[model samples]
Target: MAPKDPLLGTLKVCVLNLQSDGEMVTDTNPHLASCCELLELVLRKGLQQPVISLVHRDYWQCFEQLTHQDPCGRLSALSLAVEQTRVCRKLLSAQGRGRYLLRLALSRKALPQFITHLLHTPRVLEWYSPTTSILRNEEFVEPFMSLLLVLSHMEFKLNMENCSFLDESWLLPVCETYEVVPCREVGMALRYLSGRVFVLNLKPGSQAYVDKFICPW
Candidate 1:
């Protein structure tokens, strides 16, 4: 159900558009870029008119800051994601950087992991004021994440190589698009989850782990 609040309602529409647009989203086409913009607008909508002035922020900018704040590498995944985006010789602008990382996460099927990771990192999460940002707001964040779980079923075949032009604009020449058919292994896993029996293979010497997954049943 869409939130009754007008702001959350608008965001829900954008999220639904992402699902309704098609089974796949790629920046090589402008339509996906348009959808990204709508999402971006909603994310920034709350931050745009703050009682205080702040730097023009993109989601990636938060990751960049998080990388600096976490020198110990406690959050190595965030650090690596930030580093990859930073070293991507193509993107020059923050907007392009954000889109690049977003698409990368989508294509890798790791967007949910990234979102959950961000929620746990308060030092970085504070950039978004709880009053305006959906990611920070309790009323809005859970629904947004639920919609993402719905998206988890769809395959995203974004071309990371096509990002060189993103610095200029989201629109770009078409490269290619494909709806990846799930491999047989995935199908087998689905069958197992559906109640098919399967044998387990566990190898271990010890570490308080031998009796855990290795015990007879």
Candidate 2:
């Protein structure tokens, strides 16, 4: 069920649903192949959404299996997937989902190349327009930010893990500077903006807190 506009977010949700349900989407028929590619891109975008908690679980598992089957090729594909995830997270958080999708479709793998190619793509700059109302609500903000942090840590060029280290006794000042603005932004919505932060423990209490804070829908 495509929306009236059938923008990228809608397409991504559909594709994720299909993947989660184990639908046989592949690159066999030309049109279907294109659809698979589109779905892949959408999944990349969905990685940035706030609603899907296990963003990389299934995809990464499938990718791991693919790599085990063909280590050489699948590794490259994995790298590309991670890069796309980073790009998608950056675009979605800074911009909006529709705009990010349009740019993603145009710029596909614009990371290792020239940023000029990315800038030249349509809808890339459209996100900054004051008139560009968010197609999706801002509830996606937390997930978007959390994914941005994670993806920023795990991208192709930056193969680092996330380490939460709060610059002791400075969170309030930092939040005071960045969190207060004209609009109710994500920075304001995040509850820990005023606290000493550390890598959220995923075992128990901290894990539950992280799940509440960063869990994708």
Best by TM-score: 1
Residue 207, candidate 1: Cα error in Å is 66
Cα lDDT tens digits, model 1, 75-173, are: 676667777888998788888888787776666666666777777778767767787678877777787677566556667777777776676666765
Where is model 2 poorest over a 10-residue stretch in terms of lDDT?
163-172
* TM-scores of all predicted structures: 0.63, 0.20
lDDT tens readout by residue for model 2, 102-193: 22322343322222222233333222222222213243323333322322232121111111111121011112122222432232122244
Report the Cα lDDT for residue 30, model 1: 40
Candidate achieving the largest lDDT? 1
lDDT of 1 at 114: 72
Point out the worst 10-residue segment of candidate 1 by lDDT. 184-193
| Pairs of residues at least 3 apart in sequence or in different chains that clash in candidate 2 | 50-143, 50-216, 50-217, 51-216, 51-217, 52-216, 52-217
Clashes of each: 0, 7
